[model samples]
Target: METTILTKKDVEKILTMEDTIKAVEHAFEMHGKGLTQMPPKVYLNFDKGDLRAMPAYLEGKAGVKWVNSHPENPKIGLPTVMALLIYNDPETGFPLAVMDAMHITNMRTGAAGGIAAKYLARKNSKVFGFVGCGTQAYTQFMALSMIFKIEEVKAYDINEGNAKKFIEFCESKGVDAKIRGIEEVCDCDVLTTTTPSKKPVVKEEWVSNGMHINAIGADAPGKQELDEKILLRSKIIVDDLEQALHSGEINVAISKGILEESSIHATLGEIIVGKKPGRLSDDEITIFDSTGLAIQDISTASIVYKRAAESDMGIKIKFFDF
Candidate 1:
């Protein structure tokens, strides 16, 4: 048997935001139905950043992603996050494909936010607010645009250049976008935050009712972006309960005793499967605490693998001689 090797370019050519959203939504539904296996992410700590091992299995597909976050890598002209995924055949314990997962990470993360907004935000949501206009912000916008009209984009970042660049990206997509203060950016129908701030960058007072927030950046312990009070008031939905408490946006608040485990409204999976309701009223404030999930990667990788296989897009190598 041969294993396919897909480079970043190959995977990018095969994956799309629309397909990613569908696959991620299916993964969440399967998770909600208790049909998938996803263990807690294993972590390796480093002085500069960290590495993580994420594994999951669902619907006959299995994979593990080895991903790293090195904050200082940018100083050396490298990306902050990079990843590789090994897709496997569950029955035979054979590697079926090895593919770049960095784009998978971004697309699936953005798809999660879009899925969250689909269920949690009002259908009329059009004004999208982005706090921290980095690469992740672009994918988030792409996913949101898939679901909503996205009449206007409000962007904010400490580095004005990043925000301006994001605005240019939005304009290139034929969407109207402008840079705004963080608070003003929050004054929108759907708000997405992608900052890796230990201290809260968003204020509670600024987050009004009828707003749905995607708290995207806090994927490790001690990282947070939303004010605790905002979490206290908002109907908080997380990708996973234990993971959220350990490393999501709510980790800090939960660790500080400002928030309790019982306060979380539901998992996005539960909402997807209709075990729980979403957005009961337009005046309600909702927050999706997205720590990212392994099922997302595995499911998305499955799509890329199938597309690559059909198109003969990547190189194949036989690793074992029987």
Candidate 2:
């Protein structure tokens, strides 16, 4: 059997924020209409990190992603998150492509953030704030820029160096960027949090009405970035209710008996499918709780595989003969 393998660089060359946003939006629509089959993410917790097994099947594609997030990886000169993906043939049950998934994960997650902002944020949003200026921050900003004519950006991170680097990246894209305190960043029209914090860093008082938030960082239980009060007052929209309640931004709040499952406004898919409305009023606070979905990975990987094949970028190897 022949299998194609694509590296991170190969994947990046074929993927862009513009195409990814549309793919993720379509994935959301398919998932919302019950046209896909995706199991809840299964986890394996360790002393310093955790691993996740995510699998899904769409109309003509199927795949599984094995990924891990190590918070202390930067100390060892490695990324905080890494992943590998296997794209298989649904009809024959054979592997078609095996590729690095780190880039795919970042891009899809960022696309999800962008899609959320499109449905939930006001059309005229300009000022943007980013908390936790890291790898995820770059993609999040890229996705937002695709949709809005952002004028200014305020960034904040515990590591001053990370904040500086994030600001520079933004400036490279012609965005007015600077480092600011958490309180100041929170005041922007659209705020995105991408840190792996264990406690709340954004205070309730800092959140103003008519603001939209992308709670992108907290994907595991006990990890939270926003104050419970913020969730209480905001119209929370999650990618998947089961996953978000167990691992996304609202997990911590729900565990403390503060926010209820019923309080969640709707899934992003629901809004995409027209089952629920999005951004009803300019003054209503809207929050997108993203936990990253298996359908997202599979959908994005399909696009990457197709593009790589068209460009003849990946290496094809014979792994088996029958």
Candidate 3:
């Protein structure tokens, strides 16, 4: 059997944030309507890193993403997150393509944030605040910019140099971008936290009314970004109930017995499917706790595979003797 192998650059050449947004939105709709099958993500923890296996089947596509997060890698000049995606033929149970998934993860996560903003953020939101100026932060900015006419960007990172680089990139994109203190960044119209912090770095008082927050960092158990008071006062939305309750931003709060499962207003999928409301009032603060979904990976992979095929990108290798 012949399988297509695509590199990161090959996949990046054909992927667009706008297309990814549509694909991820459809994935959410399918997930919300119960048309997709995605098992809960399974994890294997290490002393300093963790690996996750996320598998799903949706709209005739099947795939799995094996990804890892090593917080200390940056000190050694490596990325903190790396991923590999495998696509399969759902009908024949045959392997189709193997591709680099780091970019896909960034794009889909950013797409989820943008979709959440579309449904939850106030229409007039113009200022965007990004915490943690990494590759994921760039994608989040790109995706949000695709949806909103962002006028200014405020960035903060543990490494001031990294934050300054992100600001320069954003400024080159024609947005007024500046590196700011953490508390100052939290005061924007939309705040996205992507730092790998176990403790809450954003205080409750910094958040203002009508602010929409994309809590992107807490994808593992014990990781949290926002104070419990922020969740208590906001209309909390999650990507998946079981996953988010266990690993998303609310996980720490739930474990402390301060937040209840019933207090969660709705899942992002529920809002997309119109089962639950999004933002009720103009002054209501909304938070989208994003635990990345496998359906998102599968759906996004399907698009990349299609585009690659049409453009004749990547290498075809024979790996099986049948």
Candidate 4:
């Protein structure tokens, strides 16, 4: 077996926001066509922390990935989440590449947001509000800033320092936006909540007509970013019903009976395909529940794996046996 190694910096040289957007769209198309298989996430529980193992394969696709989410790692000088992507040979099912998963995670997650916005956000959206400003938030900004002809951005994080930092970063990217406290939601045509707060940070009344909300922060059962009322009032969309049921923001809404599984409109994939309509009106409130997906990993790894192979950029390791 020959193995290719890719680090975080390699990922930087290889993938861009545009690449990720294309990759995610392709994954969504494959998903809509039923070309992928993924098991429900397996959870390992603890008092202060929890872990999940997500594995998946897409027929004819050449790689797989395993990723985890942990929001408390920053206190220890580590990232809040990490992932590992393992590419495999189709012929022998042998490992082909092992690479840092953070780049894939950040890019794919941001790409998912862009895809959702392409379908669901108001056509004339101008101002955006960001509820959490972390590293992931930066990419989320990068994705949307490219897709939408955004006029201004308003952002807030529970941590004032982070919010300020987000503003500076956005400015460095040439975004004509403002950084303010959490109260900036009133000015948004699109809103994104990307924090792991246990309590609701986005209130129902804070949402306005014609606004699209991306629920990105709440991946675990008890974590939530929006008030149930916010979910109840919107036409909710999820990546997958089963994944949303257990891991996304939809789980909270369902548990509270503010939303039933019946209330969900469609998977973003369904909207991507011609099967369902997205953002039918200019004044509708829409929400996209992002639990994250395994296909994203496969697609991203395939991109890097191919590039490394063509350029012979990574170290190749040989394994004599399985």
Off by over 4 Å in 1: none
**Residue by residue across 28-97, what tens digits does model 2's lDDT show?**
9998898989988878999989898899998899999999978799899988788999999999988999
Instruction: Tell me the tens digit of each residue's lDDT in model 3 across 1-322.
Output: 8899999998889899998999999999998898999888888999999999999999899999999989899999989889999999999988899999988998999999999999999999999999999878999999999999999999999999999999999999999999999999998999999988999989999999999999999988999999999999999999999999989999999999999999999889899999999999989999999989999999999999999999999999988887
Candidates 3 and 4, the one with greater TM-score: 3
True-structure lDDT of candidate 1: 0.94
Instruction: Arrange candidates, best lDDT first.
Output: 1, 3, 2, 4
Query: What is the C-alpha local distance difference test score of each model?
Result: 0.94, 0.93, 0.94, 0.82
TM-score of every candidate relative to the true structure = 0.98, 0.97, 0.97, 0.94
Error of 2 at 223 (Å): 0.6
lDDT for predicted candidate 2 compared with the true structure: 0.93
User: Which 10-residue window in model 2 sums to the lowest lDDT?
Assistant: 16-25
Task: Candidate 2: give the clashing pairs.
Answer: 1-320
214 Cα displacement, candidate 1 (Å)? 0.4
Query: Which clashing pairs does model 1 show?
Result: none
